[model samples]
Structure formats: C-alpha cells, structure tokens
Target: MKKETGLRWLFFFAGLMVLGLGAALTIKGQRFGVGSWDVLHIGLFERLGLSIGLWSIIMGLIVITIASIGLREFPKIGTFINMTFVGIFIDFFNWLISDSNTFSVQLIAFIIGVLLLAMGSGIYISAELGAGPRDSLMLLIVKKTHFSIAAARTIMEVVVAVAGYLLGGPLGIGTIVIAFALGPIIQVTLKYSGKLLEKSVKVESVAHGHG
Candidate 1:
C-alpha cells in the first residue's frame, strides 16, 4: 500500500512538472495556451487595478461554487488546492515580470510562469486529489448536456474566451492557439497517464492476489 501510494505521488508530481513545462513552452511559443483563460484573467485584473493573484482566487472560488452546485460529488481538497496554488504561482510569476528590467527578461519569466502553471496542474491532477473546479464544471456540463467531454470542454472554453475578450482580457495568438489545442493535449495526456495508472494498479492487484 505504501509503495502504491508513493508511486501515485510520483506520478502526480510528474504530471505537475509536465504541465508546468507545457505552460512555459506555450508562453515561449508566443502563442495562447490551449485555454488562454488565464491570459484574459491576468489582463483584466491589470486593467481593473486589482492584483491578478487576488482575481485568480476570486475566480477560482466562483468556479468552485459553480462546481459544487453542478457536481456535488467532486472532491473539495483538489478544488481548493487547484485554486489556491494557481493564484500563488501566477502572483509569483507576475512579480518576476514586474521586477525584470527588460521585455526579454519578462518574456523569459512569462515562459517559466506558464511552465510552472502547467506542471502544478498536471501534478495535482495525477494525485487524483480531486478534479479542478473548471474540470468539474466541464464534467457537469458533459453529464447535463449529454455532449462528449471534448465537445463540452471546447464549448465552455470558447464561451469563456469570448467573454474574457469582451471584458478586456488578453485574447491574442496565445489564446487562439490554446483554444484549439488544449482539448487535444489534455486528451492525450490524460489517456497516457490513465493507462500508466491502470497498469500500475493491475500490478499491485496481482501481487496482492486480487488479480
């Protein structure tokens, strides 16, 4: 059991790291993330004279509330961690940008920021601690609308991206790229990770005489 738990954690952290690296790469690519929601949020906060981190927390709470209403079975720990940690990391990256002396320096920071964000998300997700609020919401929509998960996610992201753009959020190349690519990326990542997890579980079960 201990070994299994440790392995789970290992996978979780690995996912997180990968997610962060992905984010960094997306930023470096000078393209929008697959979702690009964060870009909009950050831009909106900057315009409103509010701290982006604070805005993230606020937005996370709102999403969490929606998730609670929509998917009552979703775990709270994962939701909370996703919300809080995301805010912290965004803020940390924002600070890095502020302190940097040149656009080039800040660009590098932005890339790193994206990577960390992706990594953290990947790790937390692998932990299976709980689905992120947004993911929960996506699942809820899938259940309610009978739409495929991919379709539902794409629709939701599109709606959010449009709204964010209207609200003066960053809706640039990155946003466009993210909107088109995030679904596929997530599908691939989750599928690969799930297979690995299943194999690991089977091995454990066999050793325990349950398989």
Candidate 2:
C-alpha cells in the first residue's frame, strides 16, 4: 500500500515537472503563441514585475482557493504541491532553456509543448492524487453543470484568453490552437493513462501477492 502511494507521488511530481517544462517552452515560443493561462501569466509578469512562474503559482493558489471554497472541500496535499512545484519548475526550465530564434524551431517547440501539457495533465491527474488548480475549477464546473471536459475547458480558455488579452498579453495562433486542441488531447491522454494506471496497479498487486 505504501509503495502504491509512493508510486502515485512519483507520478504526481513527474507530471508537475513536465507540465512546467511544457509551459516554459510555450512561453519561450511566445512569439509564435501560447495558452490562455500563459498569456495571463505573461501579462501579469509584464505589468506587475514578477517572474512568470511566480505569477503562475499565485494565480494557481488563488484559483485553488476559490475552487476549494466552491466545492466546500479542502485541497489535497498533492494539489498544493502541484501549485508550488509546477511554478518552480517553470522558472527553472525557462531559465535553463534559451529562446528559439528560428520560426521552425519555435513552431516545433510550441507543438511539443502543447503535447506535453496535455499528456502531463493526464499523467498526474490519473494518479488520483489531485488535480491542478485550473483543472480543479474545471472539475467543479463539470460536477455542477454536467458539462463535458472539452466544453468546460473551452469556456474557461475563452474567458481566460479575453482577460489575458485585456491585460496586454499577446493573442495569436497559439492561443487558438490551445483553446481548441488542448482539451481533446488532455481528454484522450486521460483515457489512455487511466487505463494504463489501472493495469499497472493490478500488475503490482499481482506481483506483490505472488512474492
């Protein structure tokens, strides 16, 4: 049991790091475009004079706090970890990886970033630890409104994009891609990863039993 829990924590941390890296890539590829939350992060950073990653942590905590209130449930430890570490990882990676000069390189980075964001989202959430701040709000909407994940995410993206744009964040093709594409990818990743996690758990149980 302890091992299983530890495995989930490992998955959770891995997912947060990947998520931060993906976000960093998209931010560095900002000339090409970025996701809604990233746009807001950039906007906040530009206007408020803090690192983008710091803004990410701040915004995440705010959202998570509100979500917890709305759901009337305390956040899980994993949720807090997701909020904190993802931001740290983002800052660390952003500092480590320099910006892309070429359009082709930027495009490739953006695409890979998007894929990683979606997959990372699934990988962590599937651990049954806790959803990230934004995703927690999304789940709240899902539970209350009976909306599908795609629809809920789309709605949130639109609103967040508008807010970011108003705050002077660049809105471009990348935003469009994220608005439309990310939800489906995340949904698919969740489906597959969930199945995979289940299989792994069962395999672990069997191996331990035999041992």
Candidate 3:
C-alpha cells in the first residue's frame, strides 16, 4: 500500500514538472501563443512587475477561491500543489529554454510542448490525485450551469483568451492549435496511461498481499 501510494506521488510530481516544462516552451516560443489561461497569465505578468510563475500562482488562487465560493468546496492537497509547484517549475524551465532563436526551432518546441502537456495531464489524472485548480473551477461551472463539459470549457477559454488579448497577450496559431488539438491529445494519452496505471496498481497490490 505504501509503495503504491509513493509511486502515485512520484508520478504526480513528475507529470507536473513535465507539464511546466511544456508551458515554458510554449511561452518562450513567442511566435505562437500559449493556451487560453496561460495567455491571461502572460498578460498579467507583462502589465504587472512579477515573474510569469508568480502571475500563474496568483491567478490560480483567484480561480480556486472563486470555485470554493461557487461550489462551497474545499480544494485537495494536490490542487494546492498543482497551483503552486507547477508555476515554480514553469519559471525554472523558462529560464533554461528561453533562447531558441529560429522560427522552425520555436515551432517544433511548441508542438513538442503541447504533447508534453497532454502526457503530463494524463499521468497526473492516472495518479488519481485531485484535479488542478483550473480543472476544479471548470467542473464547478459545469455543475452549476448544467452545461456540458465542452461548452463550459469553451466559454471559459473564450472569455479568458479575449481578456488576455486585450491585455496584450499573444493570440496566434499556437493558441488555435491548443484549442483544437489538446482535447484529442489528452484523450489518447489518458486512454493509454490509464491502462498502465491500473496494471501497476494491481501488480503492486498482488505483490504486497503475497509479501
């Protein structure tokens, strides 16, 4: 049991780090815009005098607070960790990978970054940790309005993207790609990773029982 729980945490953190690295790549790939929420974060960072990660943390807190108010919900420990640590990881990775000069390189980086983000999401979900703050809010919106998940998410994305654009965030091809491709990518990643995690859990349980 301990081993299984420990492995889950390990994978959870690994997924968060990879997700952060992907976000950093997309941010540094200035030719293409990032995801809708990230656009807002970038804009906030630009107007305010703080690191991108700091803006992300601040925004995440706001979202979590709003979610708690609307749903009368409390966030899980994983949610807090997701909100804080992912931002810090993004800052660390942004510093490391901010210097790719060529357009081709930047485009490639952006594509890879999207894939990483999807994979990270899959791994984290498979860990059975709580949803991230943004996802928690998304769920709350869906529940409150009786909207389909897709509709609720679309609404949120559009509002945030427009606000970010007004605030001078990049609004470009990468954002479009993220809008269209991420759902499918996450679905596929989750399908495969879920099986793997399930298998691992079963194997560990059997081993522990025998021991």
Candidate 4:
C-alpha cells in the first residue's frame, strides 16, 4: 500500500513537470497565439507585475477557491501540489528556452507542446489526486450540461480564449488550432495513462503478495 501510494506521487509529479514544460514551450514556440489557459496567463501577466507562471499559480488559487465553494469541500493536497509545481516548472522552462523566428521551428515546438500537454494531463489525472482548477470547472460544466465532456470543454475554451483576448493576450491562428487539437489528444492519453497506472498497481500488488 505504501509502495502504491509512493508510485502515485511519482507519476503525479512527473505529470506536472511535463505539463509545465509543454506550456512553456508553446509560449516560446509561437508568438502569435497560445492555448486557452496560457492566454489567460499572459493576459494576467500583462496587467499584473509578474511572470506568466506566477499568474498561473494565482489563477489556480482563485479557480480552486471557487471550485471548493461550489463543491463544498477543500481540495486534496495533490491539488495544491499541482497548482504550485506546474507554475514553477513553467517559469523554469520558459526561462530555459528562447523564442524562435523560424516558422518550421515554431510549428514543431507547438506540436510537441500540445502533445506533452495532453500526455502530462493524462499522467497527473490518472493518479486521481485531483483535477486542476480549470479541469475542476470543466467537470462541473460537464455535469451541468449532462456530462458532455466535448461540449463542455469547447464552451469553456471559447470563453477563456475570448476573455484572454480581451485582456490583451495573444489570440491568433495557433489559438484556433489548439482549440481544436488538444481535446482529442487529452482524451486518448487520459484513457491509456489510467490503464498504465492501474496496471502498475496490479503488478505491485502481485509482487507484494509474493514477498
């Protein structure tokens, strides 16, 4: 049991690190636009005196607070962990990479960012610690709309992207592409990652039984 729990923490942190790296890559990759969430981050950064990642943490806290109010319960420790680490990782990676002017390089970076974003989401969420603030809201919206994940995500993305744009965030072609692209990738990774986590747990249980 302790092993299983430890393994979960391992996956959880790995997911967050990958997720943050992906986010940072996207910003440096494309100057034109970013994903819905990044748009919000950039927007907040412009208005406030902070980095994009700091805005991410701030936004996470606000959203989590709202989620707690709606659910009538506090978030799990993993939730807070997710909020803090993902932001830190993003800032670290963002500072690590410089923006590129070449279109091909930009395209490659954006694609990889999207892929890592999905995979990281899958990894963290599979641990079942708790969803991020926006993810929490996504679930709530899904429930309100009769559990239509696709519909709920689309609506939420549109709203967030628009708000970010209004706040002087980057809103461009990449944003449109991200709006259409990320969902299917996240769905696929989430399904497989969950299976992987469960399989690892089963393997651990079997090994423990033998011991």
Candidate 5:
C-alpha cells in the first residue's frame, strides 16, 4: 500500500513536469497561439516584464489563494508541488528549445504540446491527489454558480482569453482549436490512463501478495 502511494506521487510529479514542458512548447512555437490561461500569462509577461514561467507561478499562487480564502478550500501538497515546479520546468524547456524555427516545426510542436498537456492532466488527475490551481478555481466557480463544469470552464477561459487578447497576447488558430478540442482530448486521455493505472495497481498488489 505504501509503495503504491509513493508511486502515485511519483507519477503525479512526472505529469506536472510534462505539463510544464508542453506549456513551454506551445509558448515557444512562435506561430501557434497558446491556451487560454497561457494567453493571460503571455499578456502579463509582455506588460509586466517578467518571464512567462514566473507569471504562471504567480498566477497559480493567486488562484490557489482565492480558492483558500473565497472558496474555503485547502490545497493539497500536490497542488503546491505542481504550482512550484511546473513554472520552473516551463522556463527550462523554453530556454532549451529557444531556437525552433519554420512554420511546419512550430505547428507540429503546438499539436504535440497540446496532446502532451492533455495526457499529463489525465495522469496527474488519476492519482486523486488534487487539481492544479486553475482547475481548483474552476471547481470553485462551478460550486458557487451551480454551473456545469463545462460551462464554468468555458466562462473562465473566455474571460481570460479576451482579457489577454485585449492586452496584446497571441490569439490565433491554435487558441481556437484548444478551446474546442481540449475537453475531448483530456476526456479520452483520462479514460485510458485511468485503466492503465488500475492495471498497474492490480499487478503490484498481486506481486506484493506473492512476495
């Protein structure tokens, strides 16, 4: 049991790191516009003179604070770990892949990044540790307004996308694609990843019993 719990934590952190890598890829893809929250981060980076990674961490902290104060929800350790390391990894990846050029390469990077983000989200969520800061806020909104999760998420994304666009963030086809496709992608990813995790746990349990 303890071994399984530790493995889950490892998977959770790995998912977060992959998410950060995906975010960085999307941001540095040059031609591809980023996801909604990333639009906000880019806008803030443009106006505030901080790195996008820094903005992500700051915004994540702000959202977590709101969840605690306004929604009376306490964040899990996984949340804080996600908030901290994701930004750092984003920065690292952006720096590492700073020189990617060409439209085809950029487009490929964007598509892969989006898929990676969905996969990472699914893997982390399956751990049942807790949500990322933005997701936590979305849940709070859903709770308070009695809105469906989809509706609440859409509202938040639209607001942020608009705000970010107004502030001169990149808004392009990729952004629109993400708005429409992300839910379905994450849903499919979670379903499969959940099954995979269940299989792994069962295998581990059987091995432990034999030992």
Candidate 6:
C-alpha cells in the first residue's frame, strides 16, 4: 500500500513537471495554444486589459465550482495541485523565459513545451488522484450528453479556442496543434501508464499476501 501510494505521488510530480514544460512550449510556439480558453484570455488581456494569469485563476475556480456541482466530487489533491501549481509554473516560466526574441530560441522553446505538456498531462492523469477540474467538467459533459470522450473533449476545446480568439488570447499554430493532438497524446500516455500502475499494484498485493 505504501509503495503504491509513493509511486502515485512520483507520477503526480512527474506530471506537474511535464505540464510546466508544456506551458513553456505553448508560449514559445509563438502561437496561441490549441484551445479557445487560451485564445480568449489572450484576447481579453490584449484588448480589455485583463490580467491573463489572474483571470486564469478565476476561471479555474469557477470550473472547480462547476465540477463540484455537476460531478459532485470534492476537490482532490490532484485538483488542488493542478490549480495552484500550474499557475505558479506558468508565471515562473513566463518571467524566466520571456526573452524569446529569436526564431531559433522560440522554436526550441516550443518543442520543449509541447513535449513537457504531453508528458506532464500523461503523468497527472495516470495518477488517478481525480481528474483536474477542467477535465472533470469535460467528463461531466460526456456523461450528460452521452458523447464520446474524444468528441466531448474536442468540442470543448473548439469552444474554448473560439472564445479565446474572440476575447483576444494568443491564437496561432500552436493552438491548432494542441487542439488536435492533446487528446491523443493524453490518451496514449494514460493508457500505457495505467497498465504499468495496475501491474505494479497487483504485484504488490500478491507479495503482501505471501508475506
């Protein structure tokens, strides 16, 4: 049991690191990330003079509220971790890597960002601590509408992407790529990692019974 819990945490932290990396990449991609929410935030900030980071935090809280109401699930450790840590990391990366003045530098950052995002999201979901608030909302939509997870996720992404664009958030190549790719990336990562975790758990249980 202890070992299993420890492993889960390991994956969770790993996921966080990856997520941070992804944020950096999306920023570097010099394109709006593949979503409407980001586009909206960027648009709003650019046009209306809203603080992107602050608005993001507010949005996250609102999502959490919707998740609690719709899903009836309390905010778990993973939920809190994602809400708090992702913002901190986003700001940290924004400040630390703000000087992407050159094409080469921007390209490097974009690649690294995408890789990290894919890996982090994979790790976090595999931990199964509970889906992140945004994801929870996605799941709720899936259940209520009887839509496939992929379709639901894609619709949500598209809606956010469109809204973000209207709101004046960053919208570009990166956003499109992420919109199409994120679901597959997360699905593949979670599928394999989940198998590994299950095997580990079963092995531990057997060993414990023998002991």
Question: What stretches of model 1 exceed 4 Å from their correct place?
Answer: 17-34, 93-126, 200-211
TM-score versus the correct structure, for each prediction: 0.73, 0.97, 0.92, 0.95, 0.92, 0.84
Whole-model lDDT for model 5 versus the true structure? 0.82
**Which digits, one per residue and each the tens of the lDDT, describe model 6 over residues 18-81?**
6865675566556435344556655766876745555555677888899788877687877877
lDDT of 5 by residue, 1-211 (tens): 9868976887788788888888888887747798888888899989888898888899999999998776786899888888878889888998898657789889988998888877787778777788889778877898899986667767887788888888878887888777667656667777887787788888999999999
Residue-wise C-alpha lDDT for candidate 2, range 92-154, written one tens digit per residue: 999999887888888888888888988889889989898999999999888889999988998
Q: What is the lDDT of residue 127 in candidate 6?
A: 87
lDDT of 4 by residue, 49-79 (tens): 6899989999899999987887777888889
Output the lDDT of residue 23, model 1: 43
TM-score-superior candidate, 5 or 6: 5
Instruction: Give the per-residue lDDT digits (tens) of candidate 1, residues 73-169.
Output: 6455756766665556556544543343455654564555444444445445655766676777777898899987668777887888887777766
Better of 2 and 5 by TM-score: 2
Q: List the residue pairs that clash in candidate 5.
A: none
Estimate candidate 3's alpha-carbon lDDT, on a 0 to 1 scale.
Answer: 0.82
Most accurate candidate by TM-score: 2
The residue pairs that clash in candidate 3, if any, are none
Worst 10 residues of 1 by lDDT: 25-34
Give the distance in Å from residue 46's predicted Cα in candidate 3 to where it truly belongs.
1.1
Listing every candidate in turn, what is its Cα RMSD in Å to the true structure after a full C-alpha superposition?
A: 4.4, 1.0, 1.7, 1.3, 1.7, 2.7
lDDT of each: 0.61, 0.88, 0.82, 0.85, 0.82, 0.72
Among all candidates shown, the one with the greatest lDDT = 2
Assess the local accuracy of residue 38 in candidate 5 as a C-alpha lDDT between 0 and 100. 87
> Across residues 151-187, which tens digit of lDDT does each residue of candidate 3 receive?
6666777778789889988888888777666656766
- Cα lDDT over the full model 1: 0.61
On a 0 to 100 scale, what is the lDDT of residue 37 in model 5? 82
